[model samples]
Target chain A: MSADSPAGTHPDPTLTSLDIGHPVYAALLDPDTAFWALVDKTRVADTLAGGPLRDAYRQHADACRRELHALRFELKPSGVYLNPTERCNLNCRYCYLPESQRRSGGHMSVDQLLASLSRLRDYFRSIMPEGGRPRAIFHGAEPLMNRDAVFAAIDAFAGDFIFGLQTNGTLLDDGAVSFLTARNVSIGLSLDGPSAGITDATRHTWSSRSVHNRVLAAMNRLRGYGSWSVITTCTTENLPYLTAMVELFHAREVPTCMLNAVRCTLAGARDVKPDDGAMSRAFFAALDRTHELYRDGGRKLVVANFANILIAILAPTARRLMCDISPCGAGRAFFALAADGNLYPCSEFIGLPRFKGGHLLADGGIEAALTSDAFRSVIGRNVDAFSPCDQCVIRHFCGSPCPAEAHEMNGGMTSTGVFCAFYREQVNYALRLIADGKADDYLWDGWDDGTETLIDLAH
Target chain B: MTQTVLTKPQTQRASSPSPAVAPAIAVRKTCNPDGVGLSHYVLMDKKVAR
Candidate 1:
């Protein structure tokens, strides 16, 4: 971050790339402790024997080494997840929330919710050096379940905080859409697949209604309106239909989509999780097909998971994803606020009691929570600290693995996550995409990921 | 400049423009903190090797 030369501002035009007739290969590298450099090596070696080109290459290489020698991980959290209620309407089999919290029917009153938000505001103001306006996400269980508190939070902080909502999409009515869109709140909807058979197999509603049909209706209402996206969780049953799902997203006019693997939890729905190779291959097909479909069109389509991975590999410092990054945003970049003013690393860490940082309403809460043993353990983790990861060729690209997921599946954060194989496949596929000259399709530069890291596609 | 020309078995996949021309190659040796070799690799062609 302290680099004297900013990205995309290299003075010499020839420094960015060699004009060799052959195709140039580029990758980020940390050469040695002696050189003390971090470089996006374009690999224009001195094969010219003796010439002006060879001298120019060496000059550019030396300049590259001197320009960027260090990287800073400044955690500027983009959003805070507020769970007004811990109760969801539908019982999705793959839902990772502990069954107890799901059934507890715990809801925070409007007063308590406001108090927690105010305290959080004070805490954030004290910490954020750059002065950022972080968004508030209505998340956990079903945020819409207690609509009153959700509205109150927005009303109170609309001037100070941006707003977004993550919902199952079945409950979106015209009134809700109108209100949310009016305020420019980003809406994130969830659907398992394109059709009912794929979705209803696991997402069971109490009223026995079809989940896919309800969500599709909402999508129809949401099209060409507010800032909205869809998240379709991929499980064992829906692996074969990955391409179809992305196509449906494009067809339905959903601007962005993310495919997530079913999380491995202590409760165990292991059978539903797809194998890494299967998921990766299926995901590749989806991405390739979507690229062709959306390329020439007036509209744009973004596959969120693919884009996040690209950002991680291509622009590591500018990564905005909560998961996947080493020492993932959990206790670092963001935190999840439970209904009763409790602070968890993230919504996914809600059910696990051991991972609770502290209650936000407590005195000296922000400092206490951040300094907790669990929080320290999570925040201090890096790829170089562990095995298999330390030796892994793509450790930097992979960010090691999701520690919370690893702990849930393997009983220790040090052990790799259950989805490590699938994740590895994703990293390798991203590299292949870069090699094939198709990486720009998913390299998103729009996110305010708390870094000035510019995406330099010059080479 | 020295241009080394060589030939090898062809793959079923599409070939580059000049397969007969021996590709420019570089062997990058990675050393761990202790200066021990981790692996042996000499990259020939980026497009094919990747």
Candidate 2:
């Protein structure tokens, strides 16, 4: 290894520079140390197909493959995502939940919710005998629709758990605000765009009014009382304005921005998923603009998706962004507990019977579900086991993405994700940011994590 | 898709202190050998190191 090698542990052998996609530098993921760095395009041949250097690269790559394997089998729990009901007020075009289930009027009764909470508590105890509180994030098809059950579930756990609510935000009135605020719930509102024009088109509402105004009001109300963040689902409708949308959020004093690119998990999303090049450029532009604001405007705004990529690059172990983790945190770190006591790795996998772990209503079920074959199947998936991901340079940084989305869009969990182009572009762009010495601009920890302030741990 | 024009590695030592733990990050910043060192960063989201 050259002492001056960008990857200090891996030798950088000089060669003729190739005008590869990475341009001036090729970002290398050092499998031996699980570290990444940008080497001169001329020096990257050390790891490319050749002699001794290539042999060493292959050896380290094998080690990285094994590390991914370990991560997949490790079922360490961070929290649980609870779906109180399938009933939603808006008919969001990008909703991945089966329409039949969402309209079935099925819900977990207060008793069942309490029972589920009790089981969830037991799950925490099983995983952490030292007494660590688990996060109970009440997710949607408008979890607020089943008001009583959602509240009861919260009351049952009370101070024993950290709570969060991922809602459409239309139903978060004063009463709901007081209830969640009293319990210190971290609120994550889903608003696709900055205003009604883009949002209303994708997230439909039956009434004559706009969903954006309702959500904006909800955001303001919560921000006044406590911690809150907005999750912007990027699609073709909103792709062009991603940077502007995030800038507006920052201007409004929102703490964090979680940019979730629309995945082809369902028909609603498949139809609206942005073009690969468009999505990448939009997200990069968002990161670039927001990071500029965050740096110049006193480091208040956090573009979490961009920060997550940096974190995955800088410190892989500390990353909680599920989609970026190889094999993901799906069944291991968290599982989505549906309204009817059924469990899936995450909400996106809800209606898929093959991914169902088990029913939470069953005896000793939470523990049993964690060990179920179905759960294992989802958790056991690794990016290295797949085809092209193993050959790619940014495998560790991107994680190939959600298995549920992969299985839904493609054929299986191991198949190349539909977002491959999107991931490559984002990773390359992010690395370029780092190459330009702008990591600090987007790398932030402005929020106090002790209370889970605005940070969606499982997002 | 902005392509970075390849420039020869600068041998000039960066005045910035070497980042500890994750030296590759700082090393890549200036492409300087002296910039590599030890230390890790703590983001807002921290867990017990596995």
Candidate 3:
């Protein structure tokens, strides 16, 4: 068999690039060794001629094919980010939602929300009979703005799904806390940092009131309620305070913190977006602080990004269903149900007409919406279809550069210019952490063996 | 469940299926104990010691 030949008739889309600096990486790059020995097994004619090594390689390839087939077909939608209302009380400068959409004051009617939930329940039942509970995350400009609607949907779907809320936290008064606590709903508070200087710089209400104190107070009020996490949008303004932010979350005993890079959207203000180099530096620094808090400070703070990357390295299937991965799991495994009852591939694609999957009508339901051209277009974008991604070493586990980010930055899904460097840097960092054996320090060790089973099925 | 077949793009490399198992290799070097590796985690493909 020739060295250049593929190992199978169809190239496995799940092939990931190893950390090049790692010894395993060098071995794979060499064509002669068993490290990349499977590469030559693609020569079907030669394999049929019968060698023990070739037979073993062929057996492994067949297993991979079967696993890939199941991943592409049988994976069900894990959760839905349901927008209860597009209207947010806080008018943050870096808000990604189109101003028009945010200003529309649209709220998902209780009937509409219930209908969507019913449809989702039916779909889940059809796909996974024993999958147990599905999840619905109530999100919006401020999901708390339509508190009644959020509660109604929660009460209606409480038995059928696990409930979660992502709120600006300014609206979480005693009443809101009691309501959330009663339902045992997991809540994610958006607080840029602990200090007023950091938080008030960007996050504020429409009336120009600084929401820093209110959000902090809310965090304090809801401390003991269900699971609580923090989501901070990393912008230029908050870059310097990243370590301080992690410290704040750790101090507050917040278990998880998600430092999401400010995505460059058409509606995003230019001044708010941090430069790529600066963002990368700040992110790494914050990650270091997080590790220190865990290792030295003995804090149980989990940085979601690093934790997710650890999961990706140890478990491939966990990465597969994530939205960042190639052939993004957006429209397929997960989607955003907008306030207007319109289905979007994800929250990022909510206002974009090109990505509108279908409407969750009262009578017609969500099945037809799943098959819409918009939905199909997103679900159809496999890693093999992407240009540089097909050749990318980290293609399998790198989340394949967000397609939404690609479209926003370069006007199409084919170009990954916006997040390519950022992803590469972060992925390499995660790989380094794993190589150094410090990954477990920052990660929650409670991950079930289900991920391992999934990886075995696929890779 | 109806399987949505993912169409392989024409630009994809004509190769064999990806190896299902991770390659076996020993750890050559560990990063600094102080976690200094975090700061230098940027892509270092060319500088890799063979």
Best by DockQ: 2
Which runs of model 1 end up more than 4 angstroms from their true locations? A1-73, A76-78, A129-131, A296-298, A444-459, B1-50
- TM-scores across all candidates? 0.77, 0.80, 0.78
DockQ values of all predictions: 0.03, 0.05, 0.02
lDDT of 1 at A162: 63
Cα lDDT tens digits, model 3, A1-459, are 121233356542222223334432221221111112221223323433545434444445544334334444445666677888889888888776887766667887777778778888887776655756666778877888889988988888788877778888888999988887787787778888669888877788777688898888987886654377778888888999999999888887777777877666554645687877888899889889888877777767877765665554454343312644455567666678888888887777776788887777644556676778888777766655567765666554454556766677667866664656677677667655543446567665443223322111111
Error of 1 at A397 (Å): 1.8
Q: Top TM-score: which candidate number?
A: 2
DockQ for candidate 2, C-alpha atoms: 0.05
lDDT of 1 by residue, A122-230 (tens): 7777665455565567885888888888888888887766677888877788888877877777788888877899888777676656788889988998888637778
Sequence-dependent TM-score of model 3: 0.78
Q: Which of the two candidates, 1 or 2, achieves a greater lDDT against the reference? A: 2
Model 3 misplacement above 4 A = A1-69, A319-321, A362-364, A449-459, B1-50
RMSD of each: 10.7, 9.3, 11.5
